[model samples]
Target: MASPWRPIRVWSPLLGLGFVVALIAFALQLSSRRHLAQRLWTFEELALYNGTDERLPILLGILGSVFDVTKGKTHYGPGGGYHHFAGRDASRAFVSGNFTGDGLTDSLNGLSTMEVKSVVDWRKFYMERYIFTGHLVGRYYDSQGKPTKYLKGVESKAKRGAQLLEKQKIEEDKIPSCNSKWSQQEGGKVWCDSGYPRLVKRPGDIALTGKISQRCACFKEEELGRPGLEVYKNCDYLSQSCSV
Candidate 1:
């Protein structure tokens, strides 16, 4: 006669393999659910998660992107100082420093280079500190939820501005230092300074000589002697030419 435990021992290896396969399938299901939960949210759906109803997470939008700010409820909740920004694409507000609804649009038209920089900084702040949820459908996106021409234009403008700023920094660094002769009689006088000539141009070919003359006049006093004359002495020539 054979022992009854012989059959159990023979099937144990097959059972163990089945268990391993089940565990792998379970893990894949969980991954799929997590990915689905993080799908893109429309503006209307985002409004429901503003932390006001106490049933959903706190969410905010900036630069056509949505973020899960639930972890920062103290600052993003209903009574929080930034609660007004919840559920809206407030990129313009971030740059303009206006927390009101009027500033809560994604439109960056007519904003200055400095303002665009502020928006970019704010976007970076959100990206670093919060969970990225999805993209907001707004001026940056079309009705079909694709990136719009306006969005491309904004990106190009920002790129150009960055390039211009870099160029300005390089030019500023190239400015020659001035040699100064100090005497009780002359007080302080800048000599042996090489001037850098920058051409000024505007639309319609208007002559700007009068404006240039006015700016040059302001540099005259600094040419003589002032307490903060060191900076002017070193970059006076560059200053007169460039807008720096």
Candidate 2:
């Protein structure tokens, strides 16, 4: 009873509507994929989940993994671990250097030049976070800048750091008592005393997720008649690290 054209018109509109729905769904999927690719934790799919679970190590490890592939090497060198921690605007306290923007370069004091008030055990939580969050180091070039491959984890870097620690121990053996004077250039030949600032925890500084805090509050005081600490009270988290 229907005309041939009626069948064509009905089916064509239905088909067109179906195609439009399908197209919209496809576009949504593509958008989702793009967002997921940009994310640090691909396996966790944070898009549909709570985003707070993500932190520095999660992001840094993702970056390191991709960088390892791009450069074809582990950045931490053989038996070295690469780590990154998020400091909340630490540069405001001590930097007055020549640089621009939000980066480590913004910190005025060179890594080497500060005084050590005490040992806050930065190495302790440092290793612990690296252990919990995990790591991937890429050191593609040797001293001569030649190509290499593969990567290592915290255990490896700690072993290498241990060698450096040992060298420090040997040097310490040569200098007896706290009265002895010593200095080292940490970055850019910036010289300073290298001990002091024991980390102590303050109350109400705890987080259920991610790292707590640790601080090296001051450099050794006796050096140059002024004490120095490897790290000082730079953040609330650092205060929390000592709370225990």
Candidate 3:
């Protein structure tokens, strides 16, 4: 019979290596679970994780939602290009491109419907790319971490913008777009292959923003008198093409 001690010595190195590997895996799992837990953080607590301290993870907030952006240290670190966004909820700054103290605010006041929707989309961006770690207990969230009236209003405005965008797309499919050309010799012209060209306030734009921007759209002969559409300045009522 062989000595039992020989087998133990032969397998000890492999057993130790396996143990170490399992230990590392366990640690990683614990870290991932910690990051996934939803913790309500005050503004001051959030500021501490802004990449200024190596011991803490880099975090950012948008619309009260906080994310672990430590993986993007190249961009969110103290001297990084996007460092200004690492500490607070600066939803407005994403759209305004103002990284200053005043511009880095969460206020959606006076933002157009579409602009609000764009800001909401940025939140979606962070949600997908980074780990969602918590919520900020301020403007958007109350002491209990639930959304406040102000946040609800902003969400409602963004939802309206989404609905309008869908409606505009459907209308475009129905009306299509006019083909056009312009030059020094002919000034400008618009026409359609199977319909008439008319200028109209872009659907959902003026209605929501009080803006007067217009676009050339093609419509059937019977639909020519649809509200908000007008013939080109010098074009005849039934002309297939018109000089602009």
lDDT string for model 3 (147-201, tens) is: 9999899899999989988998898777788898999997888899988888887
Clash pairs, candidate 1, are: none
Candidate 1: residue 107 lDDT (0-100): 80
- For each candidate in the order shown, give its overall lDDT on alpha carbons: 0.62, 0.30, 0.86
Flag clash pairs in model 3: none
Best by TM-score: 3
Ranking by TM-score: 3, 1, 2
TM-score of each: 0.57, 0.22, 0.72
- As a TM-score, model 1 comes out at 0.57
Worst 10 residues of 2 by lDDT: 111-120
**lDDT by residue for model 2 (102-200), tens:** 442212222221111001123243334443222222232233323233112322433444454456456545433222223464321112244433443
Misplaced by over 4 Å in model 1 are: 1-36, 176-244
Arrange candidates by lDDT, descending: 3, 1, 2
How large an RMSD does model 3 have? 5.7
TM-score for candidate 3, residues paired by index = 0.72
